[model samples]
Target: MITTTSLKNNRTFIILFFFLLSFIGNAQIGIGTVTPNASAVLDITSTTQGMLAPRMTTAQRTAIASPADGLIVYDTDLKALYYYSSGSTSWVVVSSGINPRLNFKRIRSTDNLATVLATELAAGGGAKYVLNSNTLYEINGTVTFNFPIDLNNAYVHGLDSNDDIILRTSGNIFEGATGGSIRSLTIRAATGSVFNLNGAATQNLIFRDCIVANSASVGTISGFGLVFLSIINFSGNTNGITYNNISQLLLSNMGWFNNNAGTYEKLTGTFTLVEKQGGFSQVDGTAIGFDVSTSGLTITGDAVLESVVFTGTNTAGYVKGYTTGSYTGYNFNNSWNVRAAGIPTETDANAVGDFSMDYTVGSGLAVSFTNNLNPSNTVKVGSGTPLTTYSNLFRFSTDAANRLRYQGKKKRIFQIGGSISFQVPGAGTYIIYIAKNGTVISQYKIYGRGQILNDIVVLPLNATTELVNNDYIEVFAQRYTGANGDIVVPNMTITIK
Candidate 1:
């Protein structure tokens, strides 16, 4: 691993090195066209004129820089220096301090070889050499490159190269064969390092879009960096509204940080909402910068979240339920009052034809379920059959005015949640007289719309309190339809908002 401490903090050293190379190149130490035929030849007391100057038939000395070098001597009368190359496979006595053919040789060969012992004698072991088009083989060792503390617009590929290669924009993301792993770093600005997944891949990597404004630097020496389908930083600005729409959407910025040692540290930036279409992301930790806030806003829809949010400050919501009962312009605890036709002396063709009273609904709303009645069938109010006559009495009971007596037999009533049995009253439409028992209560209806049902009758609980001396409990069909009378009632459902 390359230690950050190894980096020279002295800017003067770098600038000075540049000056020395420039002046030395133009000055003349000794004038002549000195050249060497062999690869590892060295000479002392050589002139700068002999080493440089154009148009001279001088073999280009492979000017290579080396970390390891061995000592060599030219003539005892001249200065001394050492030289090494793959050819000699050992150090050779070259020009002394007078002409130091660099102690190292630029091994420019395309052997595609691994672990080649090029130089035999040296201060250190064999120095790994690299050329423009040549591969820097890792061979049997791991190579680690630290990030430039002040890199510009670089991102963590996180999977691009084992050797440290901070990916720039596009194109160069993946050039040739990449083995091992390459990780990446993230930033607040849009540097555009996104990778093209459509291209050929030789390494493994994954870059996930973040939900925070700023993420930290990329971790690890990457073999390859992955940046696909990702966005840059964002500024959070949200609009709070409420309405019913097809869908609702929410979005957040990607959180980023740098690792100090192995601990991940936050990167700095402002948090803002961006236009991510219908996408949403939730990330942990803060983008190092201040002024970041938490967003708990809600978006609602059957499918995925779009741009709008329903049932939230920036969104809207709706209601649904069952519509019940009718408005007779009277607010009374009207129990399900059912009445059969009076016993008429004039019988239909055959007395066997029974005349019982049944109920049908009115436009206003409501119902009554008096099926097994001791009384017969007959229609009233506006005479014969009407359109409202065919409504289903999801719940059934008798009229409250006349009241009811519970025979203790369970009467089945259908409702939204399910079905339940209860004791009502009357042969014609009875009332279950709960007068003996103290006050008792029940949720008239709940699965859905109770507002509409409330119109016909407020819970008669208050009414029961005002019950006169003979005031008992009974069922009253407000304007519900589909009962036993002139109308043939069957399964029917009523829905409301």
Candidate 2:
């Protein structure tokens, strides 16, 4: 057994056995007996039919044979996804769809309104697709939009008077389908291209924060029996991002560009008028007082100019509109930094001339009156609602330095009397913020003691103050508590005037 000839034969036999093991082992997948960079050949066999061919499990070999349909294909890097038809087995990158998201990977005809995006392996194998995670729907007979529902429901048909189907996405352009709502709901095509819809009679549409540049495909828009609010570029004018012109259209709160690029009627920088077929009127405010903003501009449309009995030149420059309302002419103001008043010329006077409203006059405690405010100097409380406990008091004041104590006041500069409440503990600094329509107007900081009633938490924001008429005022207050404060506030009485 220990002979040299037998030992040599055993070594040779072991070496040959190792080569056989190499071919069968799944642990290591190599190309061939050739070098590591040699061409790869896969030997994959399976009993299943119509099932996917197994991919090359070997990482060392780069290329893998494609599936029969080929749509179930994928690349090393996932970028574009595709679908392979079982019949023709062709690939489709774009399918009729809606609401696309980043993970969206594939496409299919069974898609409903809620079915959103489809995506998967970049190489497009496995025929992967993703549906709308949040689903969509058309409405049943319920006309009102109580809330959004699944889009796939059959009763959610989207047809309007003109027989155009409309699709509505929040903060998105309204693209009508073939037979539901009016087609004019889509983005306009080009300058002067006509999109006449004067025959429409439906709901008042509120559109905001959008763009409608003129397109050759969708021309100038003309319409009837429609209320349009805040839709930019409805006029088919390419110049301004937010401009619109409609015939027999009711408009409100909507800003328009001063540049009269394409109004069929003559317009002035001061006033731009259009024909009013259906009577229009609102809360009148003309000539009660002059607005602090711009002056001396032209007015177009049904707006009135100086009316005269005869052709004579003996009257002062004055005009009134058919509607009993006054409006500010176009103002060239780009800055939002509204000024603070009662600061002795420190406020930017220029800002007052840009806004359509007036500037503030003095400092404040604050006041509230729901009914009527007489006594020009007094804070009149009519009957709004919700009387103030100690919780609703907001105060803002300054110190010896001209520097404002409230950094928020410095940023927003002014506000309507909103609500302010506070929590005082021992002695320290407290900050109060002022706001107008939920926006930050100003802030004030105070140093004081809050040991009055520890358990009794007093809400901060108190008397809501707002200037009547063109009236406006700046509010100011000081926090008596020092930095190291533990001060107690007595029943604080705010002086309203």
Which candidate comes out best when scored by TM-score? 2
User: Over 4 Å off in model 1, which ranges?
Assistant: 1-165, 169-193, 198-205, 208-363, 366-457, 460-497
Write down the lDDT that model 2 would get.
0.27
Q: After superposition, how far is residue 281 of candidate 2 from its true place, in Å?
A: 18
TM-score of model 2 (CA atoms): 0.23
Which candidate wins on lDDT?
2
Model 2 stretches with alpha carbons more than 4 Å out? 1-20, 25-191, 198-208, 213-255, 262-497
lDDT of 1 by residue, 51-116 (tens): 431221112222333414442223221123345544555545454323433322211122222323
